[model samples]
Target chain A: MIEGRRAALPPVARLGDAALRLVGEAGAMFLFFLEAFGRIFRSWGQFHKTVRQIYFIGVKSISVITLISLFTGMVIGLQMYYALAKFGADGFLGAAVSLSLVRELGPVLTAIMITGRAGSSMTAEIGVMRISEQVDALRVMDINPLGFLVSPKLAASIICFPILTAFFDLVGMLGGYLTGVLLLGGNSGVYWYRVSAYLKMSDISGGFIKSLVFGVVVCTICCYMGYFTHMRRDSVGPEAVSQATTSAVVTSCVLILLSDYILTSLLF
Target chain B: MQANTPPDIILEGLTIGYGEHAVVSGIDAVLPGGKISVILGGSGCGKSTLVKHILKLHPVLAGRIVVGGHDIDTLDRRGMHCLRQRMGVLFQDGALLGSLTLGDNVALPLREHTRLPEKDIRERVLSKLGLVGLADFYDYYPNELSGGMRKRAGLARGMVMDPQLLFCDEPTSGLDPVTAAELDQLLLELKKSFEMTMVVVSHDLDSMRAIADHVLVLGAGRVLFQGGLAELEATQDEYLRRFLDRKAQERSTPRLTMPPLDQKMMKRDCGKYLDE
Candidate 1:
């Protein structure tokens, strides 16, 4: 019994150390977020740089967003059509598909996709810059590293995430129509009419709000991870950057899912 | 401009390290104007940490750092920025922004800090690059250049604003002998031509011998020795002796044995000196 208890429970000092580390990490993340946002109004001089980031994060993500959303919508429509067909409620297919895409899948999938696509890359790029001492070089130059390096990324993500989510919603709706009305021999008029009837402004607005918050969360976490990753003495070389990138992606994804549940509960 | 001027940097009772772990402490020294002061140490002896304290990269746990007559700990944000404007740092790896071309990298400070026109900025960039022997390589990327070329480019970037004080971290660590000597000559020329005060952190004895006017040796979180190279060479300090004569193999003879000094003869007459 004693051995089991020992195995189950770590030492009190180790637990305290872990708790303290978590608190420190939280404090650092909060300060970094505050600093990044604090510089927004003052970073107008970096307008061109922010634009470039938007292009890189938003514009470059269009094709993948479209492809993923369309396929997701088609799968949802086909499944819902067959499921509703059992009850002679085939006309409800559009409402089901559209609601699922806009209310939950659109924003969440967009965020996860971006976490995989751009967020991990941001972490790796900044991690490389950090280990290479380019970040210190900026500090030496009398430039606020947060303002010069991170704020642009934050602003770009916040502006792009909502737009990308909107694109995902639009393409998803179209894909639902293709699968439900044309392919499955459902009445086109009834399908779209039910979709238009059931989908409210609240649903769309909730998705947009979630996308914006997710954008902030993902970018802030990724940026913090990359900026503060002190390469360990034993774990030198390119693996450090890879480790940070993986951590950023995983943390962003888990936070997105957790926050999604909270937002859904509140918004509903 | 540096002639007969006060020291460019002063540290008093300084301690540096991360939280709760002091790497180097009790560092009281002055880097005089228009001279190259070398901070020399074996690896992991807090040389870079001391330099960082002067650069204001991190907080000093105890003591004060005065740069150009301004106390660093007391500087507000704007004051810190102004102080930084007067100094330049050449990192060990050059630390050029990989995304920008060499010309753009050199012109980064002026573009960010000054309101110079495109034409003037271009001219200055070219001139600085020319000084560093990277005139034709302005359009090249950092990855395209060799290590020595990158260091020179970083030097050009450092000199773009005509800084009064410069800090170089391990400027000769990974260069060939000829290239290292050339860099030393270039540093000598810059010191002469611009009258810049330079604080160089190095372990390379050859580079230190070539350029150092003052040497501060650090070890075990303290200043082991601080003086001219000749004075260091003349010292009998065992650690300094071992470091200076590092290339020699271990002696087969067990160790030196010396006769003990007479206690009465070695004792200082503090009473007489104090009374006098």
Candidate 2:
């Protein structure tokens, strides 16, 4: 009734297992590419559905971050004004708030949000595919497993992250307006003008490009972790899938941070 | 094909495996064309591995794999795809993609390998599903289907391409006895109608005996026996006698124990492991 752990295989069954042996070198590579291309092509129609998925996973996940980022901007504005006015320089509040949010805070905060919520689910979804043999089934049918599983999610993230970041930037700026007018007794026009004036095309594009690259890294690492799921002969179960999901998010976030630094350095 | 067509499978010393662990090697068996040749052996006998290589799912590490006139190991990418497009495989777990509806699952091969219009694909998918007696379950996902239905759906997918050679791994492994018998009968019917070359990897004697025209019995790492089914049943070798009767005779012994490992038995295991 309470068997803790069962054995992997009985000896008799192991003695007679027959699997077809792969013989050619080039044939294997060709098969691999064929699968990748097939998966990619078959996923084009599913792309829109994937965008819809992003709308669900990314856009819908934006609400909490929206509240947090707004409050964060307000808090930053109030704090900066208090510190600067001590030196009789509180008027720099607009430039200080705008510069920080545009160049850094808006993108950083949004990235963290997506990475925690949408990013983990994307990994988990793909991880489930890997463990469930959905990937292998694709391979079996001569379809590329990666393209079907990864392309849609990657493409969706590429589209969603920028839009989400823009939303973050917009909301955070509004928070600044509230802090300047309602909380700090300053002109709303000055806050709005200072924020827009400090913004550049590079700031916008850099964040977009960073988020795009982060999407690929997250999906690829997540997909890869799941693909090698059978690494454990004894326990290639759903728990392996959970580990893959965890690894996918952790790896993607780390890669995003590292690459953001590199990308920023290069672009600026 | 008519009943006159000879069974044929060509594996010219076909060897396949991962790094340092050859699963199947030196396989020179010819499973006759247009007939079922069940590769019967104990578990881990490299039967499924051999079927995978023949299907070109795995790369051939050495030797030639000839199926339906093409040397599979030498085919280019397009050529390999062309070859696979014509061969159907039913995996043991009935490995249908969970995301796809049963209809879409069966239609997948046709859609990929052919530029058949969506309407035509639908018709063909439905027809194949019908063949497996799943005419009404087209929209159902794999999880919704019972075990037998899932296996039948897998069969439908494999058969959609109308492949010349069909490789099935353990078609009736976990199903109940009645379901297993029914599956065997269905396979026999499919073979009779399609005239397809079937290479089934299974241990079920009733299934194998019901459909297999030729039997390739593998043990250790060697082709312990390969020939007509009647001959395998007649084989006097201890291993053959033990293997064939082991399951059927389970009630007689009540349990299976290690049968005194000797140098010869150890050599057999090594040979089986080194085979491909």
Candidate 3:
């Protein structure tokens, strides 16, 4: 009985030590952004390579970006036509599709998809690095973890979001055009003219600004989730990665949608 | 960037962690120039954390880390980067970037720190890779290499900068005994050739015995033992004794995790063939 108790004691002691290490891991989480920024600027060659990585993480993510944005435009076009036609203002289809896709759906949906595809990969990549001690290795070499790991992703999001939004704008309008004029027989010329004319400066500008903010939000949340994944590495399972993917997408969606409303009201 | 200091690396009550709590604390160490010291411990004993504080990877929690006569905690980003150009590190499991080729990985620090022409960088890469016995494998991707080769490739990358201070974390974990021995010999050769002050963190007893001029044994955030191999062999501490004994067991043990009888029989008759 005494030997049994002695054997149990060491394991309990190990648990306590593990718990303390978990706390240390959590403490490292908040330093993610600062660390990445420091690493990027510290090495000029790393900075150049970072630019290349950002291109891959962002520009390479464009095909999915295009697909999701186009579908969203189609969905919203159908939804708006129901209410607009109920009020007997069918001609506003052009105005509706353009305004909706440019100011709201284009940026928001594009951001959501990017978060799901690229953001999760970022989190998993960083999370694996965190668990595997790649981050710790960087520190020992006097290389900052954030500069090499997190900064390139953040910078990539910044560059990609706007161009992706532009793509979202073009494709979503095409989706809207297909759904509105081609499907519904709402004159194409009238639809194009109204969209172009009705879209105020802020509408396009608001969409652009939202893309930038969404970029930060997506990268921040993804990096944050991955950066602090030490707690759930073993128990977190594939479900955790999926959940992280979901949370990132959902958070960026909520932020983009809510902020679109706020920015629209403020800018207009 | 390094000033004239007797010891190239110094830590005084160096405390570091996330916030409030200290992961590695009360560390007072001085690494002299031109010798190899191994920070010996098992996983999560704060050995890695201790090395981070010395490198000033994060803000010091409550102590001082003076490297080459300059206080590391006081240095800003650019200042730290400048100081870092003087140090090289070989990370465990070879954290060579998967996106880069072996030659490119070796050339990374040089390309980042200097404006040397492409030819000069390539020449330097070849030299470093050659030193690590990877002369013919420069263009290979990290995925193509074996585990031991990857570690050597990482060592080549670390050496490309010709750093005065070199740090290697867990240099021999998960390697075959012969490979680990070869690596230990290479590290000794590198130190003598370059006059480098090398700090190696490992739980490998064979490696510590083979390469260390001094050993700083750590357990939980305090120094358990600090001395040369001869002194370590003569110590009466039970914790150190059990620790070193386990390492010797690991070395002689077979790759399969079953009992020794199975390993012996398998080696003698090649089990499947014997059964047939």
TM-scores, each model vs. reference: 0.90, 0.81, 0.78
CA RMSD per model (angstroms): 12.3, 11.2, 7.8
Q: Which scores greater on DockQ, model 2 or model 3?
A: 2
Error of 3 at A212 (Å): 2.4
- The lDDT for every candidate, in the order shown, is 0.89, 0.73, 0.77
Question: Considering every candidate listed, which one attains the maximal DockQ?
Answer: 1
Q: Enumerate residue pairs that collide in model 3.
A: A35-A146, A36-A146, A36-A147, A39-A147
lDDT of 3: 0.77
Q: How much of the real interface does each model capture, measured as fnat? A: 0.79, 0.41, 0.41
- Pairs clashing within candidate 1: B24-B221
Q: Mind giving the per-residue lDDT tens digits that candidate 3 earns over B152-183?
A: 99998888878888889888998999999999
**lDDT by residue for model 3 (A1-268), tens:** 4335545777778688678866774465436655665555564556675677667667787788778777877776777666677898767887988887888777877787787778878887777677656666566555556676778777778788888888988888888778877887777887788888899987888888888888877787788777666655334745565565566567656766787778778865
Q: Which is the winner by lDDT between candidate 1 and candidate 2? A: 1
Candidate 1 residue A23 C-alpha distance from true site, Å: 4.2
Whole-model alpha-carbon lDDT for candidate 2: 0.73
lDDT (Cα, tens digit) per residue for candidate 1, span B33-108: 7899999999999998898889988899999999888898998999888778888889988999999999998998
Candidate 1: regions farther than 4 A off: A1-20, A231-237, B1-7, B249-276
> Tens digit of lDDT per residue, candidate 2, span A1-268?
1122222446554343322212342254345434543554463566665777688657786897789779877887888878878998776677777667766676667776776787667656656766555566677677655666665665666677777777777777778768866787877776667666777778778767766665555545555555655553435578877776676577767766787789778876
Instruction: Give the runs in model 3 whose Cα sits over 4 Å from its true position.
Output: A1-54, A76-88, A140-145, A228-246, B1-30, B41-44, B58-65, B74-79, B236-276
